[model samples]
Structures are given as C-alpha cells and as structure tokens.
Target: MASKDSIEMDQELAKRLFTEGATVVLLDVPKGTDFGIDIKSWNTGENFKGIKMIPPGFHYVHYSAVDEFGDIAPRVGFIHWFSKSEFLVKRWDPKEEELSSEPVPEEIVQRLKDNLMNLDRYLGPYPYDTWKQWQELTNRIDSTIIERCAPVCGYIRSALELENCDDKSRPRGAETSRKRKRGACLSDEQKEQELLPDLKPKAGTELRLTELPNLHYPEGSTPAEITKHSLDSSYTLDLLLSKLKQPIEIIGELQLAYVCFLAGQSLDAFEHWKLLVSLICRADSAISVRRLIYIEFLRTLEAQLALIPEEVLYDIVASNNFVYHNLRRLFANIESNSEVDARLKSEAVRMRDRISTKFVWDFSNLQEEEDDEAPVVVSLDAE
Candidate 1:
C-alpha cells in the first residue's frame, strides 16, 4: 500500500509536526534524528495569561551545524497547496532569498518536497512557476537518502515567497509600527525607565556608567553624573541607551557621542551617530554644526582608549549610506584634508593622553631628571 520512499517521508514529517509546539501530537516520531529540528525560541520564556498562546515558534532544522550554512529560523507556520501540490515554509524576512536554496541539507529538502506533493490531495492549488523553479534547482543536487528515488520536477520558477503576516501585526513589528505610533512616540513607560513590575526586568537593566578618571562633562551631566558612581576606566555610557529611548531632536549630542566613543561600544556608538544624523536633518542652524559633530566623532574613534578598530570604524561611519542624515555637510574632515589631518590628530593625541593619564597612568610634574642629554644638546651645539 505504501512506496518505501513515501512511507519514510511521512515518518519524518510526523516528527517535525509533532515536536514543533504540538501540544496534542496525533503522530509519532521515529528513532534517531531525534526531533529533526533543534528549534529554540531564542527567548527566555513566554509571558501571557491563561487564555493560552503558542510561543513565537522556531524550527531548528539547521542545514549544517557549522557556521554560515543555511536558513535556520523556524518557519512560523506551514501551509499546503493542492494545485501545485507543494508545501510552503514561511519566515519573517519580507524578501525571498536564493541563498537558502543551495545549502539546505539533503534529508530536509527531500522531506519538504515529498510532503508538498502529498499536500495536493488534502490542500488546494499552488502557483505552478514557483513550484517548478524550486524543483529545477533542487533536482540538480541529489538526495542521497536511499539512492534518491523520485525527484519531483517542479514547473514553478518563483523562489519560495512565504511571510508570516501574523507576526507583522505584533507590537514590535517594523512594517506596521510606524502606522500605529503615528509619530507619537513609544507608549510604554519602559521607554522612559519608568515601567511597572512585570515589565521592569524585561525593559533591560539600566547599566551603571563607568567613570574614567580623566573624562569631564559639562553641566546637565545626567549621563556623566551616572558615570560618577562607576569604577575604573569606565567612561559613562548612558547617552547611547538614552538615544534609543528618545531622540535628542537637536544637532545630535556630542556628550552622548563622546560617551559612546570612550566606552568603545561600536554598536552603541553607531546608533547614537544616527541620532546625530537626525540632528543634521534638522540642522536649521548652521552647516558647521554637522561638520563639527563628525570631526568630534572621528576624534573619539582615534583616542588611545578606543576599542573599535580604525578600519571597521571607518567602514561603519564613513559609508555615505547615511548621507541623507548629513545636513551640515557632515564630513568636512574628508573635504579639508590638511585641516582635518592637523586638527583631528592634535585633538586625538591630546585626548588620548588625557584619557590614559587619568585612567591608566597618573604622575605629577617633577624636575628631578637626568640633565645629561639636555646639556649635551644646549651648550656644546649652540656655542
């Protein structure tokens, strides 16, 4: 009654279906291959009331355990098509990519193909071109599972276009978020470090600003004030987090940028750099303002205490991908080659020494020194 290949396909499908958040599994998984998916929620756990809800699910059907191998995020949902006789696996990224096609593991691909064909009996039509395309590409690669019996030739050409619309409607969903917020602002008090009990922990802990001994900040130094309580070599890094909470709306914030720079957190710095870019957009004041920020940003990167590498720092900040963010002709340093070289280097060295002396090295001026070298240069040569 069963072709051996079809029977095997059915078993593997059963395993995936049962293990994937299935509370009431009607089918059983075979021995070996375990769950067939190592799907992790990658979340701590779920938070919901008794009405009952499924976790944002994941399927761990990794193409290879090695890095850079395959599409690993679990398909949020599965659907069957009768017309094309295929099954569709959907992920969140809006654009469908061709990369996942090549590196998929043999067993999983075969499993998906066989399961898709069977869906025709129970489900309705699927697009022909998309199905065919998937087949043509996969067929070139053989399934080694038992000499690869029957390869379904797909007449479809479209790459798999599956998206979970449900997830897109969730609160944090990017596409719908702007429409919902209506430029009002993030509603959660957590945005302002003012969330209630259930949310307080999840909002992420407020980090203590590390005080680097030498760094100084002007008044209204709340970010810097927090840094006051910190231990050694810690430049207060509050501004980076604050910007994410709410934009400064001015010509960005030099204090925030400098803080991020001193902390050597590139991701945080880049994000704040964006806020400064926004300020550039509003640069209704002066073109020089934006250039000043860029210059200062570069100066921070060049400081001796900086952890970010010059090449990477350049790639991230210098890429004009963020050009529109510049209003005050942001990178004057790049244009005025001589001026930038002189000014930026001088400031960088000065700041580097200051940061180093206050944090790592400290000394007092003392005239007690070896005078032999100075005398040799001063008296005999001059005379």
Candidate 2:
C-alpha cells in the first residue's frame, strides 16, 4: 500500500486533471519552465470540476516510462508541480545510450525499475479480463473514473431539456385544483381573445392635451388644445386592475401595465404586474411555459420603461434585484441615460448605495416601499 503522501498525490493529480485528459505542467527546459501538453489522466472517476472531456493514454508526451532525461522543461528547467508525483511535458527525447558501455550502475538500474513500477503498477494499459477489478479499484478513490464522459451544460443543452419531461412534474392535488377552477379558465380565455391589445396603438387613448402638454406619441404630432378628455368608459381603470390579478394571456397583463402607466398609476401597475410575475415564478428558476411568459413580459416592460423621461426616472428605480437589474436596463436603454441627462438615475444610484450601507445595521424587509400609490410624479417639464 502507498503511504499517505502517495495517496494524497493521487488525489491531487486527479483533482487537477481536465475532462479532456489534459493537464498543465511545468517542465525542465533549457531556458525556463515550459508548459507541457497531452498529460493524460489515469483516474477515470467522475469530477464536477476541472477540464471537460475524457482522454486516452496514447496522448503525446515528452518521456515514456523508464526514461527521464529530455528537453521537458526547457523554459523553467523544473516541473511546475501541479500535483504530487505526476509530471507533464509536450516534447520528449531520451538520452543517447553509449554503443560500448559497462554494466548498468545500481542507482541507474533502480531508477528505471521505479519508472517501470510507476507505469505498469499505477497507470498501464490493462486487459479486458481485469476491467471489473480496475473499475472496483478506481471506484475506491473517486466517482467519475469512467474513461469516456463529456461535460457540456449551458444555455444550449438547457434549452433542449424540454423534451425530457423535466418540466411536467405536478404538485400534489394539482389536478383537483384545476378541476375546481375549471369554470374560471374558459372565461379567462374568452376575455383574453376579446381584449388582446391591437398590435399598435391607434390614435392613442385621448388625453387632456394640456395635462400632457409636451411630447406626443407620434413622432411629429404637436401639442393641441388643453381640453381634458376623460378616459373612455371602455377603458375603465377597474378592468385593467382586474386583468392584472388574472393574466389569462401575457398581452392582458402587459396592456394593464401600459394603461396603468398612461393613467398615471405607475406604481400600482408596476407592483401589481411585477407581483403577478413573482407569483408565477415563485422561488423556482426552472424553465416552463409560465417562466417563458414571465421572461417575455419582463422583456416588454424593459423596452417600454426605456421611454420614461430622464428627470423622473427615480420613480422606476427599486431596491429589489429583479426590479432593479431588469428595470434599470429599461431606463438605461434611453438616449437620456448618459450622465449629461441622468441626474435622476444618479440619484437612484446614490439611494441604492445608501441602501447597501444601511443593510449592515438592519436585517429587516428590504423592499423599496410596500404602498401601491405612485409616490412622486416626475414633472417632465421641470428638467
């Protein structure tokens, strides 16, 4: 049995090895330590860390078992000890043996024997007959000791995971809950089909030309008479709020948010809609149809808030990460996001800084505010 240090060395080497069977090592070079390539990993146990991709023993190296003298570390002139005992080199050439020579020295013979032991005993090409024994042996040291496994998990594989029923697990009694609410589902769908927002706003909802006395939605429409046009009964505020509580389709919730925005109920709509999203997502970050819809909703809100006036951007900023990272990007998209016109954003930043500073002292709830009322109207003209 190997001593503690030898076992430790094996463990250390296994930890540093990459999936592709590559390892970084410093080799003895004439100039300095040179990086070696094709250093294969003999341990095939599974590891969650290090390089990905399994490797074979046939990979290139500077030296074979029983031969050591070579231009392995010309760069550093010594192996950069990545782990215990194991060494790596890209280029290897054995020292020339004399044609006429005396018997091998005891020290020289011992060194060759040690090298042979390292190869044949530790990491050698074994026969199929001993495959099970080898597997059992490696299993004692590590888990991912297989010779052919790949590491590949990113947005790409994560996207394709939808086919594997990863998203279909149902909560206990979910079928019963759906059955109980069956009648409500049809009405919700019907409502969505009827009031789906027309792709584009047509001659927008009438407003008091004076109340919004500055810019108009259309690029060139100038401000006209100041008469107040009470919002049409067809677009009741109550209906908009009701729609938010039940997002039959993403469009309805989005429309509700927009109308609330236009009606100067920015905070009410922001909280209602955002809370609906939070409820849909809850604590689960897994992908689902609901999560996809929520993501789309976030994208839409981000695009619209970009048009908010620079001077009043403070109202949109929030201490919540979900609110801030996404919502701030919405504002940041505007041409007015620059330091020249983003005094409100600057103020928001200061507020956030203060919030982080204060967190050290208090560990209570950290929402910006709980009230649904829109606190301060940005006087766009004041700027």
Candidate 3:
C-alpha cells in the first residue's frame, strides 16, 4: 500500500539522521525543567538527558529551571554551531540551578560516548518540522557573528543578572534625602539594610553588539541638508556600514538579535532588533546605491515578519510602532526614487502589497501624509 511505502521512507530517513547527526548530552537536569531547541519546547521527565540527531549547522538551545512551587525561572540559552556527528556534553549545577559553568571533563565525555547506546532512550530527537524555516532565518549568521555579539558569559538570559551597587554608584542628593526620611523611624539593623545599595544588571552580561550611529545630523551640514537627513537616514546608515567589514554583516547582526529574542526571550535583543529595523527601513537613498543590500534586507525582513506570532504582530502594529512607521517611510521612498533598480522596486512593491493585504494598511496616502508634515519656512522682514 502507498501508506506502507511512506512509512518505510520515513523510517529510512530517521535511521540516516540518527547515524549522521550530532548529539548533545545534558546530565542531571531536574524533572519538569523547560527545554527547547529552535521553536519547539517541552518539559523534561526524570529520564531526560538531552537532544540527539541534531542536523549540522546553527541551533539555539534554551532552558528554564522550575521551582518546587511550579514557578519557572527566567530563560537562558546559547547558540551552537554543530558539526556532523559531533558530541557535546553539559551537566547541571544543583547549587546554581543552572548548567555548570565549568566544562565537562574529557574522560567523562568519553565514558558517556562509550555508553551512548544505553543512554539513547533518554535523549529526545531533534524536532525536524521547523528545521527548514530555522535554516532560512539564520542563513546569514555564522560563528564569527556569534562570537562578536554573544555575551562574554556565553549565556543569553531573559532577565539580566543583578548585583548590589557600590556606594559610589548609588543615587545621591534628593533620592538619598527621600530614602532617609522614609527610613527615619526604623531600627539600626533595618536602617543599615535600607541603606544597602540597590541591585543593578551585572557587568559582562551585555551582548557586544555593534554600536549604532547617532540620529543627529552631521555637524557641517546646512539647515536644509539637516532636514533632508532627518527625513532620510541614509547618511546614518552609511556611517554604520562603514564600521563593518561588509554591509551584509548588518543583516547577520539583525538575524542574531532576532534569534536571541525569539529563542532566549531577551528583551535587550528585541530592542537591538527594532533599532536595526528602523535603521534599515529609513535608509531611503541606500535602496538605490546599495541595491543588493536592500534586496537581501527585504528578503530577511519578509521571513522574520512571517514568523512573528500574531499576538506579537498585533502589539507591534496596533500602536503604530517603529516597524510600521519605518516600513511606510521605506515604501514611500522606494516609490519616489527613480534610480532604484527595476527588480528591486518591483520586489518592494510586492512586499508593500502583501503587507497592506495582510495588515489592512493603506500606503496610497503616503504622499498626502508627507505633505501635511512638510516643514514651513517663515520669512521675517527686519524693522
């Protein structure tokens, strides 16, 4: 029967994957811990070890610890570039309730490998359904981009790690006076505790993302030029590109930020992703000059937008957020710029049409809207 043939084919594919794919050995994680790769997630069982048969390339591995009361800790994750048939071993630290910072010993890794067959039942197969989509989203990212942008601590956390601020870093003046008045009647021990420094995000936990150029106009620009640059951020885009070895790297960073936010749930990555989107969408002149970059940008943005959950999309579009505003500006610029390549302009139009149909946005009134906000020059005669 045809059904039997399909089952056999699937079985063969599974065997191939099991024989050729990489493996990750996670040791001693607690039951009910949340674990996931790419877009798939599940709570772990007592017998859970890690993932196996992972396709070779970039993948995100994330997890969150669950407490006795069923509360989940903030998510933490890392990106890994797997080689075919590679083996990676990691262990949990009960004290820290996280993956151990220290590397697994080579002897232990070898022992695990020697007994991998016995442990196979404890491992989960990589979720294959979304693998192709994940590949497309991360096609531009590589090891170099990961090393450049990932935090020094090697973990992307949904919540920033906080530490007590030193006296020098604590607020002074009015804030100090207000705190004093509030704590005036407290016991000495309580007052000492109140005076203790507030907690702040720990150093070294920040992603080393490329610095974005300032939005201000260049110093030597005339008034008219400043106004023009304000409307079209092509000059700022050029400055940002100049700092990179290649313009495409911007797309890589964009992909990295998006992945961190999507998989690790890091808000910092979300903000960086938004900023990058704003920069790209506002570069009106760059569409013509950097035709290839614009083409790739459109492709990347289209894929990312398609994957965004509807609820998130609602939040982004409902408030006329940065994405909606900048995309409108980008489309308008593409429509008016005669120098843009025909193919690029056609692509932009198609994207615009798709966005309009999907989001019920009206792009036809852009000209009228721009005219309404046009700057007025007042002329005054000296008396």
Candidate 4:
C-alpha cells in the first residue's frame, strides 16, 4: 500500500482531472517573453505552447515583451473567466503587440485535447505554490461586485484612454480635470463633496469602487452640533456604514485589490485602492471603527510600500496623490488612547518618518483640507 502522502497526491491528481478545469494554448508568442497567469510566471522557450489545468474562474494573464537589446514593452494583461472545461486559444501578433483570439474549429480543439499527453512537455502545470495567495486575493470578488465594477468594454486590459465623456461632477462638460496647483486647498464645498456618495463609477475605464459617504456623527456631536456646522449627508459615516452592512465584504475587496495589484500588476487594482482610500479617509468613521481597522490598514500599506519596486512606487505616489494625503489624514485622527492605539500610532508615525527621511518628502504638513498635488520636498539646508 502507498504511504498516506503518496495516496493523497494521487487522489488530488485524479480529482483535478475529473473536476472541470480550463486550458489555454498560446501560439506564436516570442521565445523570450515572460508570461504569467494568476501568480505563476513562465519564460517562453521554443516549444512553449501554453498553460494547462487552469482552475476555471477569473484569472489575469500578463506578458512583458522583450527585445534583443533588453528593452521591455509596457506590461499588458487581461482578466478572463474560463468556463468549466473551456479550451481557449490565442495567437500572438508581433505587429500589433497583442494576443488575438477567435473561434477555434471544433475538430482542431478535439485534436489538441486528444494529444494533450503528447504536448504535456510544452504546457506548464498549474502553480500550486501560489494558489493560496491567489485564492485569498480573489475569494471575495463575488459576481455582483464583478458585474458592477467591470469596465464597459467587456474586456479587461491595461491602457489609459481619453475619450469624449460627460464630466462626472458637472454632467455637461467634456473636460478632463488637470493637476492641481502647488498649494491648493479644497474649498468647503470641495471638502463636503468628498463625503458625498459616489454610487456609480464611470464606464469604459478601469473598474473602481464607489466611496459611500459617512452619515454618522460621534456621540458627542449630536444633530445640533452637525446642523450648526451645516453638515449634510456628505458627513454621514453612519449612512455609509449602513450601506455597507457587511463590512467584511469591503475589507475583502480591499485585500483582493491589493494582492492583485502587487502580484498580478493589474492597473485596475490601483484604481480600486484609490476608491478604498477615498472611502476610509472621507468617511470619518467612529473612533471605535477606526481603531479596530487602522492597524490592518497600516500594516497592508507598509507591506505594499516595502515590496513595490522603487520606480513603480514613485510613479504610484506621484500619480495617486491621495495615497499619502489620505494616509496622513487617517493617522492624524488617531487620538492615541489604549495600548493598541498607541502601537498603531507608533507604526503610522514610523511610516511617515521613513518616507520623509528616505525620500525627502515630508508628511508633517499634510492637511486634511488640502489636495496633495505633489510631495513636499524638504531640502537639507531648510533643516
């Protein structure tokens, strides 16, 4: 009789075959390109065909085309949901620098399926090593969220395009907002707008979550206190929390977005991160809620900051101005009470100091009312 581990491995292999899985056959891809699905990466060789036994669901396929001189094209990727037993195929177009797919003749697909054993050497196996991470990243992305957040184009890929679309705020103009001035402070109206509910994100672009407005005030700030300040639905964290009845759903979405962003290089994930930051910062959630979740948020942010490549990190910080701005705002409100709060505050301060010391960018002057157009560079002479 086989040992327990051997028996388990054999059982797993047999179960994988019986359970529905998908196959991808990529043809004519450049020999030196790096291709990946989910968390598994493969360097293409002469006989490279595709990946096999893909567990059927959503997966991100990405590639970096390389040239003889070691130059790399901007990485491009797409997300696809493979049906059970799906046999998808694609052919690479060198001129277009993209993969193109069409309906494969049934006979050809049948032949490939029958000869899978012969082609096994060319097909890479599903990466069990990275499956757990991928699962954690994707498990919370339910069908409803997927349907809501998917770009209108019916295909998911990375490329920023400017088109004639209605201005979200004005609804009448075709203007795309430009970068802010060096020292711009948001007006009272602008500050309030941040708390307004953003129910539907624009279509034909990367998917992003809506920032549900906060409606609840802390115990001390009653209706009269809020009314005196002319606080509208915009400052209603209670309302936002009510809308998000299942807070775990939101947290899971954040984790999924972050993991996809870091591991799969999904630009869509970056957009999602921005949405999450906007929600958390502007919601002005109760102190208890903030205390409970701030550490997790801080830890996640630190992990991302530590792991991201320097070049990419700079680009992200520069392009996504809300990143540090919102983080600073989040940290500013932590009233430093219990031991947990103190520890979280320490971590937050450490992160701020690290960025200031290493990057010469100071978060000390970050104001909640100001739009962070760019980092404040501190000169050595000024110190």
Largest lDDT belongs to which candidate?
A: 3
* Candidate numbers, best TM-score first, in rank order: 3, 4, 1, 2
- Candidate 1 lDDT over 1-383, as tens digits, reads 98999889867754544333222110111111111112111211122101001111211121111113432332221111111112223221224321122233556545644664353232211122232332321222222210111112211111122233343343242334235546556756635532221121111111112112233334466644434422111122233323332222121233333222322232443455555444333222232323454454444323322443456546644674242223213232233334344554455346445644643422222222224312222233444
Is candidate 1 or 2 superior in TM-score? Answer: 1
Q: Model 4, range 1-383, lDDT digits (tens) per residue?
A: 88999889967974784356777888789888878887667678988888887887767777878888877766666666777878877778888766754555778777887897797688886675666666655665555555655556543444544444434554332223432222578788866855554333345655545454433445578546555323222245445556654654565467657655665566767677766755565434344455545555665565555555677767857876556666656655543334334676677678778866865665664443454333344344644
Model 2 per-residue lDDT at 239: 33
Q: Per-residue error at 319 for model 1, in Å?
A: 4.2
Q: lDDT (0-100) at residue 189 of candidate 3?
A: 83
**How does each model score on lDDT?**
0.29, 0.30, 0.85, 0.62
Task: List candidate 4 stretches off by more than 4 Å.
Answer: 1-20, 67-69, 83-85, 105-107, 164-205, 208-249, 252-256, 263-268, 281-383
Record all residue pairs in model 3 with backbone atoms less than 3 Å apart, i.e. clashing. Answer: none
What TM-score does candidate 4 reach? 0.58
Task: Report lDDT (Cα) of residue 257, candidate 3.
Answer: 90
The collision pairs in model 4 are 214-236, 214-237, 215-236, 215-237, 215-238, 216-236, 216-237, 216-238
What TM-score against the true fold does each predicted structure earn?
0.21, 0.20, 0.85, 0.58
For model 4, how many clashes? Answer: 8
Model 2: per-residue Cα lDDT over 41-77, one tens digit each:
2322122111221132222122212213433311111
